[model samples]
Target: MNSKHQILVIGAGTGGLMMASRLKKEHKDFDIAIIDPAKTHYYQPAWTLVGAGTYDFEDTAKPMADLIPKGVKWYQDKVTAMDPDSNSVSTEKSGEIKYDYLVVSPGLTYDMSLVPGLSEAIDKGNVCSNYTDPKHTLEVLKNFKGGTALFTQPTTPIKCGGAPQKIMYLAEAYFKKHGLKDKTNVVFATNGTVIFAVPEIKETLMKIVDRKNINLKFYHALKRIDAEKQIAWYELAPEAYEHNPAKLEIEKEGNMVGIHYDMLHLAPPSVAPEFVRKSKLANAEGWLDVDHHSLQHNKYPNVFGLGDVAALPTAKTGAAIRKQVPVVLDNIEKLMKNQAADNKKYNGYSSCPLVTEYGKMVLAEFDYDNKFTPDPELKKMLIFDSSKEHWRLWILKKYGLPYLYWNKMLKGQDV
Candidate 1:
């Protein structure tokens, strides 16, 4: 069915749902329709907590129909193609749908093929990923017999840059809880040299790492996994050791390191959806190419993007979208009225609640420059310093954030 809307939003995710909810609240008369095929919308941020066995997986989701804001139309259809030049999109069930303005925020997807054996090994034995199957992560952690427990992330950008480490910290805490701490060799093999981009947060995480005695193997990118053999192979980046990326015959001769593990938890490599990647809206990296500040398409002003789909040089997070939604909504209003921006630019603000242990957390907030800028309002009301691990922050993470997400953010209240 061919249809046209004043504002067409893709994906009822944090970006799409919030955009529709906020806009509908202010501009009730506007014709807005959101497209998403899913029946349930999952709060992915809480998956880390689920993997740690603290939060129930079922609590992380709700009926998408329940969350769709009143007065906003919802289309249970998947986006197969996006055509910004024509200001239209093609859906799986629906035919070509035209729009005056398009909001492209179809979130990223994971491809286990990016890493060998990742798909086959998922949830079968000790191999588990919080992003894919968080429930199985809980099982893996519970069944751990205490050996080398390796946690790693791919080089490709994944949902919430801190997620990989969050699960790592939680798994370590779980091991400690089960009295497996002494027998377990907790190794964090990450592609990055630093614990975190933000300096203050990095310092805090480092302290936690030292206290837990977790070994940090810097610049180690997960290349492949032999799940059957219970071995994970990693490729070492040359910059870390001042060598070159080389592959010879064996692990000792090459830049590869294989570690056998009794338990392995990993964050799978993820990328933008194929439809957005092949479209004209995509950047060189296959993500929606939008102005980082305005969240407007670089080439098409009628288009806006946010959330994990946007190719911004920052973490893909719901916290980032909280800041981005206002900028996008403000700009959309201005463009409709005068086709000009009112200095409403996003500062690339994203916050990650790094759960160091079962009871402590560090609220790592930062901007485009990786500056550790804590929320002044939070500091004034809650904790003054977010650089240190605090039980109060953990309480906020486990309870407060989810409340704000559903009742405040999705319910069309200012967050």
Candidate 2:
């Protein structure tokens, strides 16, 4: 009910929740309030396995009420408009709230409707996307039998770039397990020219694709889906125009082609929310305009952001948020004390446990410069191999991660 607070955190997702919980633990004087419309908190990383039938959907989600940090004010309302200059944000249910400091981490929006016939295909069976709601995952997987199953990644920046292919790999493993490998054809259709960003990882992925006999289609963008005919239309690059062959040249540039598919797994385009997108604080790419080092708003000093919505030029994942939480908290604490904070920079450290199969994963850890930051210490401490396809990594992903996320990361307990 109070409209004023020392700090207002928009969204109760990983970033927002982490920031609020950390701030509450560090500074008792500051009144912290969190606004979110959702009633559940999902460990989104687990959805890949859920789609693959490896993990139960129920295990990936938890009640929002139980997750909110103790003593912090919780407002279950959607943010309608955010006015950075006035230090106020309006909500759908609760009119307006004013704050001394604001943290925007509402997360990105998944625009599935942008793809033609995608909605119908998903409803009609034969198409599923693990990047969205988990309820439909089981239905889609159950219907998949023996046919050309296509997995696609959009050109736009996504929350977890590796996630699209992770599910594909899982499906490939599932087909093999169920004795349908020979009958079914698996394909990864991506706009990117390479499988993985890191050269080391890409090399491994290429071997896996070849060994498994999975078709890899690059520079092909998903155009439309004909669910009825089970035909997915894709425009290949280097498309030539008949009217002006010499003057116009090739539009697609040797990359124009089309392919039909029996089944499709679509990854929708993602972007910052309209409120954040339209705001001046957003970058040209429509992400929170923040210093990559400070995680503070480039324009508004009192505002800060992290996680998927931030304009940090790195893969958006919860692992990135784990490293960012402390930096943001320290900076905010120092600012509140009217003291200059030490420039503790974040090197865009993000991890993607690339699950190549049900029991295998390539723990890809890298920073902003695309350099490996392997946790050899973790391997030594746990007494396990850090290589791809280890049961230890699988257990870490299945049980260890969710526990760490809830008890440590969200609670602001530094490990």
Best by lDDT: 1
Per candidate, the number of residue pairs that clash is: 0, 11
- For all predicted structures, in order, the TM-scores are 0.96, 0.92
Cα lDDT, all candidates: 0.87, 0.79
Q: What is the lDDT of residue 139 in candidate 2?
A: 72
Tens-digit per-residue lDDT, 198-250, candidate 2: 77777777777877778776767777666776766666655322210111111
Report the number of backbone clashes for model 1: 0
Residue pairs clashing in model 1 are: none
C-alpha root-mean-square deviation, each candidate: 3.1, 5.0
Please identify model 1 stretches exceeding 4 Å from their true place.
241-253, 342-344
Expressed as tens digits, the lDDT of each residue in 1-415 for candidate 1 is 8999999999999989999999999988999999999999998889999999999999999999999989888889988998888999999998989999998888999888998988888777898888988999999998898888888888899888888889999888888888999888887778887889898888888888888888777888888888888888888878754121222222442878787777888888999999999999999989999988898888998999979999999988899999999999999898899768554579999988899888889999999999998887776546989899898889899998999998999876788
Please list the residue runs of candidate 2 whose C-alpha ends up more than 4 Å from where it truly belongs after superposition.
238-256, 341-344, 381-387
